[model samples]
Target: MPVRHFDFFTAERRLVHTNPISLLKDTRLGIEGNHWLRKLLQNHVKEPAVVAMGGIPLGLRAAIERELDLLK
Candidate 1:
């Protein structure tokens, strides 16, 4: 099931005094799927000095910088 659906089910279950489904330890990666990539990008953008020095194309780099500024 999708995360949103599972979240709804969990909330409903709590209201009914029932336990929510347990998170699967073994399938964590399959479920989360590299959530760290967003953090990695955010970290890179947070450091403007390093962003200016990276070898990415000027246009794409500018776009990323703009998005980072908005995120702040």
Candidate 2:
């Protein structure tokens, strides 16, 4: 359920898949939660910051952990 959006484009075409934060935005943990979550798996993000996100997305947590070696 926790899937991020991805966009791939070429000279003549574009492809997009989006799964931006859903229910979280509807809760008390809205935009602020989204900002950090957006940064979670990025190459520049480090462990401490990742930890501060409070938690990871339901389905993607495992993959995120694997991608972020420190979390593994």
Q: Residues 45-64, candidate 2: write the lDDT tens digits.
A: 44565466777544456645
- The global C-alpha lDDT for each of the candidates, from Candidate 1 onward, is 0.48, 0.46
List candidate 1 segments past 4 Å from native: 1-22, 31-36, 43-45, 55-72
**Model 1 Cα lDDT, one tens digit per residue, 3-72:** 4455467687785453333443344323333433343455554555555787543354665567546534
TM-score of each: 0.25, 0.20
Go through the candidates in order and give the C-alpha RMSD of each one to the true structure: 12.3, 13.2
Best by lDDT: 1
Which residue pairs of candidate 1 clash? none
Task: At residue 68, give the lDDT of candidate 2.
Answer: 49
Lowest lDDT sum, 10 consecutive residues, model 2, at 3-12
| Most accurate candidate by TM-score | 1
